[model samples]
Target: MLLPVVALLAASCKKMFDVKPEQVVDQTQMYRNVNDADAAILGLYGKLMNLAKQHVVLNELRADLMDVTDNANDALKQVTLNNVASNNTYADPRAYYQVILNCNDVIKNFQIMVANKKFTRDEFNQRYGDVVALRSWVYLQAGIQYGTVPYVTSALETIDDVKDESKFPRLSLDKLIDTLIKVTDSIPYKDVYVTGSSLVTTIDGYNTGKFFINKKCLLGDLYLWRSAFTKSDIDARLAAGYYKQVMETGGNGDYDTYRIKWSEVTTNNDIAVGYWNDGRVNQYSENMLVDDNDYGWRSIFARGQDALYNTEWIWMLYFNASFSPENPFIDLFSNRGGSYLVKPSQAAIDGWDAQVQSDNNFPYDARKRLTYKTLDGQPVIMKYLYNYVDETTYLPTSLLNKPGKWFLYRAAQLHLHYAEAANRDGRHKIAYALVNNGLSYNFDNSPGAGTKRDVTNTQQTFDPETAYQFDARYGDNPTFRAPWHRNVGIRGRAHLKALPVNGADSTTLIENMIVDESGLELAYEGSRWADLLRIAIRRNEPAFVADKVYNKLVKDGNGSAAATRARLLAKDWFLPFKWE
Candidate 1:
């Protein structure tokens, strides 16, 4: 319906993450009707796609989870080693700002369309609700990754909009939060899902609820970032309140709104058999070992193609090959055949292995196997892989007609976000269940008839292929369940380094555990850098940050340990935007 333009040809970060004058559309014409407004909304998501993979490198690779293999290009290596420069090409200011400009276009024009009676009141709020949340989500990403950035809200309709330095100066952290809070407060569908199974026409084709931001999800994360950056208990409480609203809405007591579809493991007729061989259903095949899907972990990525409406993804970015062109992620991360510039760090592989609780004849944390694969003595990161799944399974990737589905906000992150903020705010009971108990919990401490466990009943068994812990059939109990008491869920399934109900840890240690759980769940998904940076910047704890991220990279010989440490200690933590 509409064609999205590239970054404005003007200076990057020089003028409000400027876009050239040609990039701006006629606000009057674009807001003519609901259909016209829908086209403009599509443009916003197109720009978001441009930022999706860039965010991964900006956040994930800069942290410890990734490293440049010998085959990686110089620019990628520089970012990996923290040897980035001011004019380096990948350090593009337009990456974040481009998304902002698209958002600004929609935010600026919504009221015009609404006043014209082009859309009913509810439809206008529905549209306005999305525009508001999308803008905040962009700013949240900006605040976490880039220290201070030029903030703009009104449409950049002229060269004057592009060149006016006095109009939009880089905002301080506090100012960014103020602007964000004001915007988030205005959305009508805060914790609520607005799309009701109807498809809207956009540049990306017809789509549903998965692509739109859930207002409370954005607000909760925004507050969490503010709390982490400012170290304010007040901010932390605000974040928890929003997250509590999210829990109350769709996924109450169960991550049903955002969980993996593990039922397909056994339910599918062509499902890989013998995934959990425990001598029960001998579905093993020709290979000595079971296939990756048969093992349970690979299914997450395969299933991610349809995860949009699921509980695991609060919101995600979808790409349509026919409507647009190519999904950058598929080109960048896919292994079927592409220029593979990066891979998982050896440290990440080792760290994941070390974190596993028990062998049980396979890997402990399903994420490790699910996240990466070893090739040529190196770990090829496979978190976004779908080609293999398309070839063998009935996953929705085939149905999506596109391969690039980037998860922006997710439930596990929220679980830990709530836990991190709650722990910081001295809400131990709330933080404890978010991780240890999981959404699968039944209200009672006792096992749910079959799969539950305890210290004395540590050897109890649930479905080995099951990703979720609680069962609705047993009556969805919104509390801790069997394996949780015996050190499951956040604990390694087999490794079981339990967060004791009566553990003798101080507040500091419990908070650390909560943050670490975020790592375990959200790893390799473009969040690690901010997770480390937020605490380091707030507490002035470079030493601790170095231990969590830098130490792992250096010890694994990713680059010179001295250079890594020196770069970290000198000046600031995040890369600076080089203004002309």
Candidate 2:
């Protein structure tokens, strides 16, 4: 792509009219000095942190997983019910566009920094890589929520540039992702090692190691999302390619991994007397630290918690409470009467309770307690928070607590993505292993196979014949023969298995399982609504979306469910690009 000469950059006096190409600030001025270079890049991250709350609203709240409280204002309720009006607060685009502007600024200016000898070539690639990743993050949100949005790459600088919002045309999610793949491709990466995998040794340290994304993470993520929108095996295989790269980056097949205590895996055997048979009110011992314990969650991953040095986050935005508006998690999920807008839906609560009740041996899912904080009258989500307290003091839990960090990507998310991609490509054996390998539960198999038989029938194990390493790209591995509902069929605490889904009857079966897993694991962290949209579009299954997202799930008043089902019938997965 060539840029026009200065002579042809604008309209001519006695010629056909043409608009001058808008230039934001002089990229040269922003990136020339080391100080400005640092500030500009840091600013990009700061801008991203600010958009975190809105990101949740657009990504998680719009999905069927939540319901609006009666206390919600009309604007919030409208979005909660998908009664999106042109002027609805949830329909605002600027919240994301502002982040795009910061990304463009960092991108266009970084080159000047390199030219001015402010950063070495290697370092230049690293900083520019961060900017590109941030851009991809925003692009992903907008692509999913808006379907197509003004794809602005360059910053809007001058007065004319600011005024001329129409200069950039809205592009499809496919086109945006194409750009994302290319952006991650350009970053300089190195092979490095961090913990969590002891297998395949070499990994690209594209933007440092595990915390900031390397090329493999970007490629894996980009292609996985891409697979949702395309019917081609090309995208599926491409996703596998990147996911394989991530796996191999670990070397020696995922050694040195972190996992929860085995005793906590399946049902607590002694708890035949637990709440429900069941434990009483959140009584897990303080010493019972799980991988997702808030202690480490805040210590290692919270914003300003020595973030740059901590690993495994892949990409995250750390927030500072000193800003004009502190971290927004409180206002977003506030339990203060009349203040909070969103709460967990009856569907989520009912589904979770049902999942636990169906298996009487199990007391509860640890994730359930961690995710939703059920108040006396109304329940609300708590995944984004535990208590807003200064980490060291834990005492003064402030209602306006501000230390919130967005966990955008992590090893667990990748693992789930790998399993789904493999399953979709018809590689059930490997999919089963990938899911089971790091499965968080340990089975209490002492109950005898009769009581332990998840299906309780002697129909034979789904894949009783063979064993092989998990590799989904090629189907040469051993087979997984678990029944459709799995129903704790696998020989473990959390009986997650490679579902019997290699044939035509199981396509929806497999898809539904993956969607269910994603919702359970990544609840309220963003990506839920995108999952709904992707599945609806990919399978051309509007009824599924309507049934799950609108009707079967929520308790509707105001005919919101019926109205939303009608829109899904129209194949509408997004609010109109323009409010109109």
Candidate 3:
């Protein structure tokens, strides 16, 4: 799979941000400069953007939280029915392989750039590690959907080269996870690239730094998969450690930059709704004032890339309409000016409706209003409908003209995944607290606990591990309050009450809660099917996934629920890898 003519990079550097951006030119002349390398990386991301709709469909449609609408095409309907045809357009692996091919080209050529003294060792390490992580992420997505894929890392001229069975053996999901962990673990630079590096740029007024793949998040995810596949405490602990690295204070001197403070959420119309720090925003619909309180949580998705958003978003990609590949989500999720093909299932709405706030006994999660909304007589996903500017206002059908975002990694995911790992590692109390309430609320509340937020909880007590502890200390004294002291667990940030852990299998119960919380907090964005599949495989219970999908199908009035469940119980968790 050696490089050939390299037609993908013939365009000038200025055209690199186009939808069909180039990856490389002639190998002998390419990677001769850092600018060349930067263009290649940007091009790789452009290719990654093409997979946004496919990624969401592959990850969520097959799972429980999302359902295809009547307007959906045959391929999408096939996905929801768990009867994807071999020729189904959505089942095609070429889009994923297109990304992997670009990542491979970048990784291979960047090494040559470093060797030729065209790039510094540090520069090469950071970019090289990023491309590697991006590739790993793509492979993880591929493995999750297809089960067995040709894990090709070498650069090649055409995607067809991987068809050679002897040279590129198809690896199963478990083996792919192992290879990703080993390869990603070996990278020297595990953190984000140094801030303000040449690789960081501004495109359409948004900083491109968040566009890059996060290395630590990728490693944590890899280890999490491995931990599930092997049921090893060591792997779980390793996964927790990596997630902690992302959640801890960033090096930019911003205290609690990546943390969701316990005080951020509110049941009443006060301060902020969730992670959004922008002052009280007036939410509007159809040029009329609807509600002011609903804007905060929505800001997490609707706001532009800035210090306020960087706190929660670890990695994100934006699609400009002026660019070649417009935001695909506008067509998939928006009911205005676009085809609303897929939507949040009734199961997802019910999941959010079941939540009750701890402090005020709020009937439903505050996030429910922000996630999806009723428009044109039907509920549609709201997260991707508006651009940063008009999230609070319905200013025409902007979905056709405004830019849309694709969330790859964020703070909630870091905490949720860490809690999953910690629970598996025998830290169930900490994990349970992290999901329902913050560490301070569930653990640090005890005798002589200074803050009113802290409470004495003897029933769920556990010795605090230094790695997972978040100090409950409060008050005006900065001397006493540690950085993570402001940290709030995932459900806590949604103002939800803590779930009691009374069962003998506390770990399993808490783990299941974590999985459920993932569905509630992260629905429609992706990761639903993968989360269910991983847990089902780990527990060696096919019904774990089958039951959820079956429930969702039945709730959505799909007659194929029973048949799909039967297929799932037969160990059919992945799409058919027809390329093989």
**lDDT of all predictions, in order shown?**
0.58, 0.53, 0.75
TM-score to native of every candidate shown: 0.78, 0.72, 0.89
The positional error of residue 124 in candidate 3, measured at the CA in angstroms, is 1.3
Candidate 1: regions farther than 4 A off:
1-29, 158-164, 191-207, 251-255, 259-275, 278-297, 304-309, 334-336, 358-364, 388-402, 437-488, 491-502
Q: What would the per-residue lDDT of candidate 1 be over residues 178-229, giving only the tens digit for each residue?
A: 7898878777755444454122212223344566777877777777777766
On residues 292-318, what C-alpha lDDT tens digit does candidate 2 reach at each position? Answer: 323332222333323222323445544
Candidate structures ordered by TM-score, highest first: 3, 1, 2
Predicted model with the maximum TM-score: 3
User: Candidate 3 lDDT, tens digit per residue, 1-580?
Assistant: 3333132333333443574315335566667777767767777787788888889998899999899888999999989878898889888898888888878977877887898899899888888988898889999999999999998988888888877879999999999999999899999888776667776666567777778888888888899999888999999988988887787747324455677655433332222244332345343122221234234556678766656677788888887776757778877887776788998888888998898866557677767777787877888888777572344454444535757788888888888899899899998777876777665555553523465442323313344654564444443333345454565677766767777677654778888899999998888888888899889989999999999989999999998899999999999877877664
Output the lDDT of residue 497, model 3: 76
Please give the RMSD of candidate 2 to the true structure.
10.8
Candidate with the greatest lDDT versus the true structure:
3
